[model samples]
Target: MMTSKNLLELFTQTRSDSEKICQPLQTEDYVVQPIVDVSPPKWHLGHTTWFFEEFLLAPNFPGYQRFHEQYAYVFNSYYESIGKRVVRTDRGNLSRPSVQEVYEYRKHVTKLMQELISKHWNKDWNPVLEIGIHHEKQHQELLLTDIKYILGNNPLQPIYGAVSNEVLIENSEREFIEIKDGIYHIGHNSESFCYDNELPRHRVFLEPYAISSTLVTNGEWLEFMDDGGYSNTLLWHTEGWDWVKKNDIISPMYWFKNENGIWSQYLLSGSQAIDPKAAVTHISYYEAFAYAQWKGLRLPTEFEWEVAQSKINHGNRWEWTESAYLPYPNYQKPDGALGEYNGKFMVNQKVLRGSSIATPANHARLTYRNFFHAPLRWQFTSLRLAKSL
Candidate 1:
């Protein structure tokens, strides 16, 4: 548990970090949403501020006045319980709230939050405040990735910052660490902050298996592509095959072959040659599954990944799991608006274990369950291979 003063310091830093992420962007970059899955950068800023204002400042702070009455309807995300707001796809259409205006809104809410935490520190305020901070951290990751999508998709291929997306692999050798079959306890067992989905640590049975010691690399994926991995229907799930054919996905997102046929990828810094040894990223779960199938291997179940996590190197990218996003035994959803956070989205999504390059610091844990629909590849998602003994 953090002291209110410590949390307040962190809150101040976290709020500033979000703005720092957007500092490299031109005003026009903040409002474009290329796809439905990605939110505008300005929207992320306002939405995170709206979270603090709606959940903490308004409810807990005595005589707290809203910064703007209409701001709630403009920034409200997927919370049905929170009343009507901008539709998901139309988020980019909200040009009325200028980028400067969104920043002002953030400044307004952040000042009130600081005052609330400094003057009247409550024991109960700790949890909600912590949630708000972590919630902003989550948005911080999204803000960076969304920025990449916006710039990467543009024909000009503008650079956002001095950050590099290419991660060089120190070792190319692949090994599989074997784990014996047994009952293993999984999920978050710590006292630290975790999302509700990782709660109620529970037991799971697993068969003997071996999981990869390292993530699959761009060079390895290139072999799959060279061998017509995208064209082979036998290696893909039915829906995955349909997605491939429909979208003509010949290579991972951000990949392109120059006139000389050399592979290069767009990074936040700029376009650069693909680092063959770097861990492959921006692949959908369907693509991950197909690659695993091509190798006569399979994705590790979330349980297998958790029990064997200590034995392997991770955190380079979000490793896909064979597990579905579901509640653990005796899992209980918190009542009211917060309940809708993780519980309601549990269906039709695959579980991804570990963190990505774009993931914010201290935001991911061993038990963290990140999920997305099988076809969404805009995120910095990747895979490691596993096989039954």
Candidate 2:
């Protein structure tokens, strides 16, 4: 249990971090959603604030006035039990509730949250408050990705900002970290913070497998493309092949050939020559799988990935796995609206392990399971190779 003072400090820092990430955006930059996969920056701001208001404030704080009563209809994402909400696809289309109003909404919720935490501590509400902070951090990542898409796709290809001071130096070389075949315990066994999906720690058997020590890089992907990886349908799943043909995809998102026949990738810091050393990102599950197949290797199963996690380098990109996003044995959703968070999204998605550069500090864990539909790759998704020995 967190003390009142500790919780208040955490709340303040997490809330400030969200705003810090949004500081680079211009007013107009907050409202445009270039693609359905990306929500407008303003919606993320409002929705995260609404999370605390709906879940914590209304239930706990007496006489808590809603900043905007109708905001719930626009911000409640995929919570079927939480009354009606704006459809996911239509979020970008909204221009009302102006950006300023959303900031005001955030301020209102933050003030109430401060009041709640400043009072004597309630052990019961502490966990919910922690979850809300982490939830906002998750949106912080989405905000960066959505902003990348919005800016990267424009004809002008504007840079959102300069690269952070801490540069990501590439791994010196890739190696295969060997994991011996055995029964292994997986999932969250720690008493610390973890999502429900990572709970109910379970056991699984695995064959001896070797996972790459580092992520596949842009230069490596260039080899696959040079060898006609995309045009070769046999290297891809049937549905993936259909998706490729449908979308006319040839390379990773944000990559293009230059006038000198060189390739470069567009990023928040603007277009730069594809770095051979840095991890390749913005790839779909299909693309990751296809790349593995092209190399006569495979993506690791989630269990295998977990077992080999500490043995390899990670936290640079979300790595696609061969595992489907599913419930563990004896999994149970928490009661009420919190239950709706991860349980409902279990079907028809692939699991990606590890955090990305865009992930917030202390937001991801080794057991964290990030999921997305196989065809969507707008996030900072990447891959590695594994093989049964």
Candidate 3:
């Protein structure tokens, strides 16, 4: 547990980080939602603020007043227990709240939160507050990805930031690390902050399996494409094949062929030559599955993924897995609105492990489970190959 003062500092920093992510955006950049999976930048700013107000401030703080009574209906996301919310598809159409008003809403909520912590601290409230901070960090990543989609999808091809020349690793050798068959303990086991879905640490049996030492690179994916990976339906699942045909997806999202007949990818900075050595990213679960099938390999089950995580490179991009998102044995949701957080979304979603480059450094953990629908490809998602021995 963190001291109230330390938590306060953390709270302040977490809130400020969201604003920092938006610094590069023009006012116009904050309002467009190119797709339903992406939320407007300004809406992200308000929705995160609204989380604290709705969860922490209204119930716990004395004399807490809402910045706007109707903001709840506008910002609520997927919490049916909270109240009705604006439909997701229409989020981009909301312009009346205005960016300036949303900033004020954040300030109003943040001030009360800080004041409540200073005057009165409750141990019970600590977990709720921690979840809110982590939730904002989740949106911080979304803010950047959404911003990229907003700009990347634009015909003008505007730049969001300068090309980041990060020296990740010089060695890109491909090797498979072998894990012997055994029962391994998986899921979050610590007392530290973790989402409920990662809890109830359980045992899972695994057969001998070998996992790639590194992520699949753009060069490797291109080879799959060169060999007509897209046209071959046998490599894809039934739903995945339909998705491929319906969307006409030939390569990863944001990939394009220039008039000069060269492949390039859009980045936050601008469109640039695809660095073949960099880990291939922005792929959906369907694509990752097909790529694994093409190589005569398989994606690791979540248990296999957790077992081999320490030996492989992660946090460069979110690695999709073959496992479905489901509750562990004897899993139960807590007794209130907080229970609604992770438990409800455990169906109809595929599990993704690891983290992305856009993920906040403090936010990534070995036990973290990120999930998305198989067809959603707008996030910074990637893949690694694995197979049972």
Q: Scored by CA lDDT, what does every candidate get?
A: 0.90, 0.88, 0.88
Off by over 4 Å in 2: 164-169
Q: What's the alpha carbon RMSD for model 1? A: 1.1
Using all chains and alpha carbons, the TM-scores for the candidates as numbered come to: 0.98, 0.97, 0.97
Candidate 2 per-residue C-alpha lDDT over 259-366 given as tens digits, one digit per residue, 9 for 90 to 100? 787888887887878877667889999999999999999999999999988888888788999999999999999999899989999999999998888899878899
Model 1, span 164-254: residue lDDT tens? 4446474746799999999999888878899889989888888999999999999999999999999999999999999999999999999
* Model 1 score (lDDT): 0.90
Which portions of model 3 show Cα errors greater than 4 Å?
163-170
Residue-wise lDDT of candidate 3 within 148-190, one digit each (tens)? 8899999998988763432133276789999999999998987
Question: Would you list the clashing residue pairs of candidate 3?
Answer: none
| Candidate 2 lDDT for residue 55 | 92
TM-score of 1: 0.98
TM-score, prediction 3? 0.97
lDDT of 2 at 313: 81
